[model samples]
Target: MMHQMRAETGPDGATDSVVSWHIVRNADLTALCGKTLSTAAPVQDATRWTLDPDRNCHTCGALFLREAPYFPDEHTD
Candidate 1:
């Protein structure tokens, strides 16, 4: 099966606020591609809990809304 380009963001009230996904084609080119292309869904842009796993700093372990965003990297932008 061919996988179409898709993007999804964390649900509302979700502890994880990080945006995920990759850009497939530009908006102008998406139509020409003949495939349903999607972009990263934007959240409320509020401070939400995020956690990084010990294995990888780029990975999120867990997140608790209203708690704290924790990461093994010790820093985040």
Candidate 2:
């Protein structure tokens, strides 16, 4: 699964963007699993980890990319 977003501002000065998630199935995983596999929800908090099986056929696996400023800050205490 991939988390994507586009930054935008509303007329009222509300700064926010709609988060979009994308999941692409892997052909190797399909062949291995012998069926179309879907992305399972994260076992733990998303900030900790995500289980995106379609991308990688394993447990507790995820791929994260920081492309834009749409994502929430991870440094806050």
Candidate 3:
């Protein structure tokens, strides 16, 4: 199956649930749903970060679900 590039990046902190996470396109800092953010936005690896449904961007999450984003380093064993 084809997958869309998704980068789960947000503020650098241990507080993952409260911070409004934005699903940006892989290699791009902008949100997948087109919500513009500052260039100084803290972007980190998806696998290394966490998210909360209630605090995340719904549009981006919906887009991500529809596209079924993939991570290259993730193994399916």
Candidate 4:
């Protein structure tokens, strides 16, 4: 199963741009959307992962659904 996490490209998640959320692979701590995990930001909750449309990175979301085909909180055959 693929693990997930949330991240941003801005410090303390404070950006004046349109994008805010970026999806990350907790296993390797890499972003599927090719975005920087903002490791330089203040300490953050690494477990703040979500698939909410309002905060999801569309690019990462699409890649995630295509690669895993199952939600982390769901059971699949």
Candidate 5:
């Protein structure tokens, strides 16, 4: 699992607004040397949630969508 976090200011003048996403991927083993491999879907740009809805994983060469965009705890340190 991987995590992506973004912070934005809301209309109420709060800069603590944040959006987080959980990225899940699969792992595979190479047949030749038995090396474990993993991949996370690659996005073209920073605005992936809006621009690249469907992207390809650079490592495993699979297709996946970003999911669970939510706010994290404000008190997180």
Candidate 6:
């Protein structure tokens, strides 16, 4: 399971960007591993740690990239 979050710039860029958080949980993982599931942490924690840790969104493996303000225009072809 994969949770997808979308961040959209607000109207006129005055307000903060709109962020949507999607939570995806896989309860069948325990059955596959023959273990019990027990945790209180956020689903992101479990996914990043136990699953894909290097696929861009993993907090621990995520590298911060500083983009320039005038990088490029979205309408550029």
Give candidate 3 regions above 4 Å deviation.
Answer: 1-19, 47-50, 69-77
**Candidate-wise lDDT, in order:** 0.28, 0.28, 0.53, 0.55, 0.27, 0.27
lDDT of 5: 0.27
lDDT by residue (1-77, candidate 6, tens digit) is 33222222234331443222122234232212232222321234332232433333332122111111221343389
TM-score top scorer: 4
Better of 1 and 4 by lDDT: 4
Lowest summed lDDT over 10 consecutive residues: which window, candidate 4? 40-49
Candidate 4 local lDDT, 38-74, one digit each (tens): 5543223323445246866778778876766654455
Per TM-score, what order, best first? 4, 3, 1, 6, 2, 5
CA deviation > 4 Å runs, candidate 5: 5-22, 25-47, 56-77
Candidate 2 global lDDT: 0.28
Which stretches of model 1 miss by more than 4 angstroms?
1-7, 13-16, 28-77
Q: In candidate 6, which residue ranges exceed 4 Å CA deviation?
A: 1-25, 28-31, 39-42, 45-77
Q: After aligning candidate 4 to the native by TM-score, how far in Å is the CA of 36 from where it should be? A: 1.4
Worst 10 residues of 2 by lDDT: 23-32
RMSD of model 1 against the true structure: 13.5
Give one clash count per candidate, in the order shown.
0, 0, 0, 0, 0, 0
Q: Tell me which of candidates 3 and 6 scores higher on lDDT.
A: 3
For candidate 6, what is the lDDT?
0.27
* Tens digit per residue, CA lDDT, model 1, 3-42: 1222233455224453442222223213222333234443
TM-score of candidate 6 against the unseen true structure: 0.19
Can you list the residue pairs that collide in candidate 2? none
Off by over 4 Å in 2: 1-36, 39-45, 50-63, 68-73
Cα displacement (Å) at residue 10, model 5 = 39
lDDT of 6 at 20: 20
